[model samples]
Target: MIRYIKNIFLGIYCLLQGMYISMLNMIRPKVTEKYPENRGRKEMMERFRGLLTMPHNEQNEHKCTACGICMINCPNGTIQVISRKEPDEATGKEKRVLDRHLYDLGSCTFCALCTIACPQDAIAWSPVFEHTVFTRNKLVKQLNREGSKLEVKTGKS
Candidate 1:
């Protein structure tokens, strides 16, 4: 009979303790995100590897030399470079022309492997992290700008 009374007191003590904690939590300040409030520059860091961008000149022509090294180094085959082989009459050899430079941002790991592998130092990270698109086709970016052949020098002169 005495042991039963002790257990009953212990259960009441535990119940009172839980109620006290719950009452304290109800009075205390609520910690929750306020989406309507502007956080200004104190925003959360966006986690993404991001896609590569070709460095352009004043006229927006890419610095790429149409080298196949970037294409070979890409682990996911995200980059597809199409070069036009133009035959030079004087040199008796075919010279490469930058026809198309396609980049699939979705498949890219952004390991910067392609950037490092490039001898021409063409590709770079452009600070453009927000690349949200409804369709997968929109994610594929073309490096070439129409009608401009302006050159971009990467390394020191």
Candidate 2:
């Protein structure tokens, strides 16, 4: 009977201890974000790896020549460079131009191999991680912007 009373007190003491700790934690400053509601607009890290992209200059020009170097270097076949013979700025004759540069981010390993293989420095990593979508087709993006032309190197200054 004495042991029973002591056990009851011990159990109550432990319950109170747990509740006290929980209460203290509950009143403390929040340790986690509220997620979607409180997430930062630009939350990507400096070195964060994301979908590969082709950067256009202020004048909206890219350096991709459709050399297929990146495509050849990609181990997973994630890159496909489409090329066509198009008229240059000065010449009427046909010249190789990049028609489309497709990037399958879903299959990409983000190994940076394609960027390293690009001699023209056409492709690079973008910090935009909000590219998530419902369908797989949305993940496969064409790096070249629509209606945008490549930057043709004409002459030496």
Say which candidate scores most in lDDT.
Answer: 2
| Model 2 misplacement above 4 A | 1-38, 154-157
Candidate 2 lDDT, 14-133, residue by residue in tens? 999999999999999986656688656547667778779999987779989898999999999999999899876576888888889999988998899999889989988878766678
For model 2, what is the alpha-carbon lDDT of residue 55?
95
Clashing pairs counted in every model = 0, 0
Candidate-wise lDDT, in order: 0.78, 0.87
What are the per-residue Cα lDDT tens digits for candidate 1 across 39-145?
Answer: 44334435334558777777767667787899999999999998888776668898787888899998988888888898878787665556789999998998777
- Mind sharing the TM-score for model 2? 0.70
Model 2 clashes, total count: 0
